[model samples]
Target: MRFSVLSFLTSAAAVSAAVIPSSSSAPEKRGGSISVTPHDSYSSSIGVLGCKINTNRAAYWPSSPDCNNICVKVSANGRSVNLLKVDQSGGAHDISYDAWNYLSTGKNATEAPTAGGGLAATYEDVPMSECAHLLKDGKHLAFAAANSMNFITSCSANTWVGKNYALYNILNTQCTWGYDELCRMPDPSQGNQPICEHTLGLTVALKTCPVYNIAYPTGKLSIAV
Candidate 1:
């Protein structure tokens, strides 16, 4: 389930709004409140199809991919710790257990904080080049797949046509035919069925067959003399 950094750069067609800056000067700092939560499976080490991240070094999950692999400087309780943005929190500045403990008490505790609460924090996105020592490879941040199952299945098929066909099937079944842009309408002339269009500049042949039945012997047969 390992993905190279190159794969991510190519597949991620749309760039997020929080683009990492190219210059060496400090980036604009964003301030927000942080909530401490218990570490999950992806707490310490990198998870399946996830970026190479060292969560032990004050890692925090941001709300979007824009912050992926970006080094963040978290300041709170008159203390500041530089942490990496490794995973998604669905909300801004979701600090990991160990990280929060370190930030508040100045001790990286194995257990959760007794007095759990939110902390006022300011996050500054440090450029990847500047934070090379913190990164795994010093340059690359392996982008995690949004949908690992779909990624694996499509990669296994290994064809643009196959991927498109799979996408069509998913859209046809899950999405509204007429309302959704990708979903196709059921053609009344073709038995009111939805079919893959050949307009994709490639010809695809689809086939169907009836189910086969198997019979078992009821009794031994005697041969005629």
Candidate 2:
């Protein structure tokens, strides 16, 4: 896959405390000024995961305490397969695509809005037997008969949501959405295809930034701005 070299902003500053904002606060105006909560929740330094800063509620994806880290859930045949903890600073969408590529090709992949032949992104079928090799735990045999294709198909057909949540909200103080600016996200496909080819069975609605912090050891990641 083709990877876009996106430059991210960074500061040497470190946050002291992190807290989720209460839902009762009135919604900040969409596509307006972004407010930064002065706290130590975010760090310019990279962590176990690639999380950078604490995002506000309006922010698309939440930053993990660890920089570049992402949590993923893999499911097949309507049954939960495994929860994956990985690292990718490219954002949630890119990380998701990379996970798919690893499962399908057994090779590391990069971020790209398009795939082979510039077609909608797609992955190869990988049988569950091969999971042991491609996945971290090379010896689990629970879904051995199932294939990666089933997982991919299930992701695209069952879990995928359209474009990520809007990035022009208050929590996304750093990103400039409507105008072409440094942090603006790429436009999504009109066919409801995810920025990532498929979803990873994450419970949270896909967000524009796709960055996240893990909520639990299993299931979808619970991300907060």
Please name the candidate that would achieve the greatest TM-score relative to the true structure: 1
Backbone clash numbers for all candidates listed? 0, 15
- State, as a TM-score between 0 and 1, how close model 2 is to the true structure: 0.21
Per-residue lDDT tens digits for candidate 1, residues 171-198, read 1110111111122434567542234333
lDDT of each prediction vs. the true structure? 0.36, 0.23
The sequence of per-residue lDDT tens digits that candidate 2 reaches over residues 1-225 is 222212222211111122212222122211111111111121112111122222211111233212111122342223222222211222431223333333334443332222221112222222323333432234321110111112122222111111111111111212211121112223554432222322221223324533443221121333333
lDDT of candidate model 2 versus the reference = 0.23
Model 1 residue 6 CA deviation in Å: 24
In candidate 1, stretches whose alpha carbon ends up further than 4 angstroms from where it belongs are 1-40, 43-51, 58-62, 67-69, 111-115, 143-225
Q: Residue 60 in model 2: shift from native, Å?
A: 11
